[model samples]
Target: MKTIDCLGDMCPIPILKAQKALKLSPSGTTIKVVTDHSCTLESMLNHFKKYEITSTEVINGVWEIFITKS
Candidate 1:
């Protein structure tokens, strides 16, 4: 699992990074993204619906979004 810290990033930055990660990662690879923004999390959740992904709340306003490339 590769982790991308998007704690301070906003909007398209987080989603953009996730896209790059997915494009670079091999099949079945899971990339873990840490975000502190609700909008960022929501964007990722909806954007990642096309693939295998999961989300876990680590704490208040903090989440770990895992995306496994299909």
Candidate 2:
């Protein structure tokens, strides 16, 4: 699993990074996205509908979103 740290990033930055990772990585790769903004989480959840969301957990106001490439 690879981790994309978007703790301070906003909007398309995180999504863009994820998209780049997906494009570069092979299929079935698992990624963990760490974000502190709700909007980022929401955007990811909505944008990554095509991928498999392994899990989402909010701890101490930070969200950890896990997705597996299909």
Candidate 3:
């Protein structure tokens, strides 16, 4: 899985990074996104809601989103 770290990034950055990664990745690929911002997480989920989101959970207090290209 490819990982995009958006720890200190705010709105749009995380989404942009995810977009870039998705564009480069093939269909059915799974990517892991790490973000510390709550708004980012919500925005990401909302923005890419059409894609397959495998999981959204907090690990060690940080939010992690797993999305699969479809």
Candidate 4:
């Protein structure tokens, strides 16, 4: 698993970072994204939906999105 910390990053930064991580990660790899922005999560959901990846909230207050690359 790869971990990405996007805390305090606004808007598209988190989403963009997630995208980069996904591209760099191998197939079937799991990437963990930590962010405080809700909009980032929404955008991530939309972006990963095509890959059928799901994001899980691991911690409260801060959002932890888990993406498994297919």
TM-score of each: 0.93, 0.89, 0.88, 0.84
Q: Which stretches of candidate 4 lie over 4 Å from their true place?
A: 56-59
- Among the numbered candidates, top lDDT falls to 1
Task: Return the top candidate by TM-score.
Answer: 1
Clashing pairs in 2: none
Model 3 poorest ten-residue lDDT run: 53-62
Q: What tens digits encode model 4's per-residue C-alpha lDDT throughout 4-34?
A: 9999999788878888988998898888888
How would you encode candidate 3's per-residue C-alpha lDDT over 1-70 as one tens digit per residue? Answer: 9999999998899999999999999999989999888887788779998898754657655788888999
Per-residue accuracy of model 1 over 2-54 as CA lDDT, tens digit each? 99999989999999999999999999899999999989878987888988778
lDDT of 2 by residue, 1-70 (tens): 8999999998889999999988888999988989988898789889999998754656776888888998
Better of 3 and 4 by TM-score: 3
RMSD of each: 0.8, 1.2, 1.5, 1.6
| Stretches of candidate 1 exceeding 4 Å from the true structure | none
- Tell me the whole-model lDDT of each prediction, alpha carbons only: 0.91, 0.87, 0.86, 0.82
